[model samples]
Target: MDRVRLLVLLTVFVDILGLGVVIPVLPFYVERFSNSPQAVTTLIAVYAAASFLSAPLIGVLSDKYGRRPALIGSILSTSLGWFIFASGKSLLVLYVGRIIDGLAAGNLPVAQAAITDTVKDEKERGQVLGYVGAIFGIGFIIGPAIGGALGHLSVTLPFWFVGALAAVNAVLAYFFLPETRKQQEAHTHPISLNPFSPMKRAIQQKDMCSNYLAWGMFGLAVASTQSVYALFLNVAFGWEEFMVGLLFMATGIVLAVNQVFAMRNFWLKKFTEPKLELWMTAAFAFGYVLIGVASFPLFIVGAILTTFGQSVLRVVMNSQMIAKSNPTRRGEVMGISASIVSLTAAIAPLFAGWLFDLRPSLPFFAAAVFLGIGFFILYSAQKTLPTTLDPRQPVVSEI
Candidate 1:
């Protein structure tokens, strides 16, 4: 890989590492303040809610100022958030930490835009993104194991460690990460900070609205399933902290292998992007259904299917979105995409948590239903969507 690609991958690895370390242990940590699993999911939702509001603004900032500064500043904010979370003594303090982190959640979109800036070849772009996904899988594999072991010692230990890593990452980016956005074309039309602005612009484009809708529905399904997964395992299988970590590790392995070995090399060559997306959505729906009714052995099968399906779907969808965007506005387009996903992230956990309180299986059932609807939308819209970009024109025409 090239130097810029490697740095972007490292940045993503460090960011996702913090998430992997925290997610498995967050429920237990929050239980120190509140006994309800619903409260834990609410904490997760609060972070996404903040991100939902901030992501487009951050994207606009990166477009106006530059990607490197945006990345470094966001990383610094994450470190501060982790520090706050580690030191907090009250539930409100925990919310404060998540809010801080959420406001800086534009790091991922900026990093993705940087990659889009450097890579011009559409096929190679998809392959490189798979590498990014592979890094995410590797981070999850290592981070959760370490976090689980540390959690056995003290719940706060993993947070301190992750905070320290984020600080170091910020310093490294300051010294080594180069600016990729061209200076001459840096300024664009004035960007609105309103969270709904990106969505409104997206909706005005007839060709793109259905794609965004499908992507948002996919986000909702995945977020809802994730919100209740650990709790479900605890209730149904009586798994401990370490076992939960192991299960996530296994899912990560499946994800990494599919991205690196299958999607990057074979599948992208074999299938059209829209066709792959449609199949993956169906796979996710089936996997969720299986998980909803699963016993121990069947649960493993369902988990593998779900991980593989989502992993492929994410890479394909992201590749298509980037390809369909004007090169100059890649950052803005990605920010809008993140905003759509974050909006779902904000809402799904609250809904899932409420359903979980009613019945453990209800969240998974809801996820399957959502994915099925997303699949239908994508399938219906496949004929109008272009798989390749016309470099001279914007990918979608505004109405």
Candidate 2:
């Protein structure tokens, strides 16, 4: 890998690592202010809501101003958000922190755009993205462990640690990260501050619409499962908190291994992106159904299957979206994708919580159904979508 690609990867890794360190401990911190589990869940939604509102705007800014400035601003915002969260004296303060973090959540898309700017080859892009996915998985796995351990000292300690990490990362990036987007004359247009405008424009294209719908469904499924998975385990198997964390760690390890080693070394060689997506959808559907059955051994199997499926699918879909988009518009397109997923994530958890109250297994079944719908959408659009993984060919929109 070249220096630019490696720097982009490092930026993504550090950003995700900060997120990982905070998430596991967040709910516990929130409970100190409010006893309601719903309140904690609401905090998650608030962050997603802010991200949904700010993502497209961030993308537009990156396009107009340059990725380097946008990235630096985002990192600074994240550091500030974590600092506020750590120092919070009230629930309102916590909410404010989350909103700040969400509004600055452009790091992933900006980093991805930076990678696109650097790597021109489609296959090489996919491989590098697989590594990014692996970094994300590893960060999540290690982050929770760090948070859990730190919580023994103080619930807010992890937040403080992550805040410092983000601040340090921002300094490093400001010094080392160069502008990847070439300086060019700005295109004249009325820049819409409305967050939904970019998303609307992206989805108006026929091919992009199908892809977005499929991606949205997939996000919904994952969000719903995440909302209730720990509770489901406790209800069904009487597992304790440590067991739950262990399970998550195991799944993350599997996912990271699959993306970094399996996909990079084997899967990309054997299957096109579309075919890989189909197979992953099938795996997701099967895994969700198995999880709903609520047997211990089957649950383990389901965890492994779902983790592998979802991990590979995420990298594959991201690669496809980047490839299908016009090179110049990659940031805008990715921002739209991020915004839609955030919207779904904000909504899915509330719906899943309600369904879980109705039936412990309902959320799992619903996740399967969502994935099934996603599968059909992809299947129907297969002919219209690009058959090969190469981005150099005319994309589906051009057809």
Candidate 3:
């Protein structure tokens, strides 16, 4: 791999590591202040809501300014948020911390833009994105194990450790990662604070709108289930933090193996990206149904299926989106994609949390329903996609 891609991958790794460390421990940590499962999911929703409002602006800035600064700023903000969450005594303080972090949670999108900025070929871009997903899986594999160990000692320790890692990541990014955006042709359009503007612009394009809708529903399925994963395990199977972490690690292993091996060797080689997208959706829907069943072995099978589906779907969708975007607006388009996911992240958790309180299986059932719908949308929209999956001419949109 080239220096830029390697550095971008490193940045993504650190970000995901911190996130992985927190996920298994968050519900237990929050229970100290509030016993409600809703509190835990709400905290996640707060962060996503803030990210939804700010990520687009951050992407615009990266397009105008450079990827390096946006990346560094986002990492630094994440560190601060972790620190605040670690020190907080009340749930409100935790919300404030997540809000701060979410407002600058543009690291993944900006990092992706940086990687794509270096590659011109659509096929090569898809391969590179698989590497990103692989790194994400690697982070998950290691982070949760460490987090479980740390949480066993003290719930706050994981946060502090992740915070410190984020801080160090910001420093590495600043000193080593070079700017990837071409300064000469940077967008000169006036910066817009309205986060929805990019979404609106994206939706105006017919093909892009179709993909975004599918992506949004996919986001809803993943986000809602993710928010309650640990809690569901605890409630249904009586798994503690350590057991939950191990489960997460197992799923991460599936994710990493698929991204690293299955993606290049099996899935991509066997199916076209469009076909993979549709098949993965079916895999997700069935997986969620199995997960909603009240059996431990069935749940494990479902988790594996969903994780595999998620890993492949994410890469193919991103590659397809990149092929459809104008070179000048790659950053903007990535930001819009992240924003759509974040919007779903913000909305899904609340509804899922409510459903979970009523019955642990309800959220998974809801997620399955969303995936079923997403599959139909993507299948219907296939006719509108480019016949060759090659990069198209820039679709001009209103600034």
Give the top-scoring candidate (TM-score): 3
Candidate 1, residues 186-246, lDDT tens digits: the string is 7477777677776677777677777788889899999898888889999889987899999
Clash pairs, candidate 1, are: none
Ranking by TM-score: 3, 1, 2
Q: Compute each candidate's TM-score over C-alphas.
A: 0.96, 0.93, 0.97
- Stretches of candidate 3 exceeding 4 Å from the true structure: 392-399
Better of 1 and 3 by lDDT: 3
Q: Which stretches of candidate 1 lie over 4 Å from their true place?
A: 390-393, 397-399
Q: Which ten residues in a row have the lowest lDDT in candidate 3?
A: 390-399
Cα misplacement distance, residue 2 of candidate 2 (Å): 0.7
Model 3 Cα lDDT, one tens digit per residue, 1-399: 787889899999999998899889999999999998889889999999999988888888899998999999999999999999999999999999999999998999999888988876766777888989998899889989999999989989999999999999999998999999887648788877887777677768776777889999999999989999888988899999999999889888989999988888888878889898999999989999999996989988898889998999999998888888777778887888899899999999999999998999999999999999999998888876554466545444434
- lDDT by residue (116-168, candidate 2, tens digit) is 77765777878888888888888878876777777767888999999999999
Ranking by lDDT: 3, 1, 2
Each model's lDDT: 0.83, 0.80, 0.88
Of 2 and 3, which scores higher on lDDT?
Answer: 3
Go through the candidates in order and give the clash count of each. 0, 0, 0
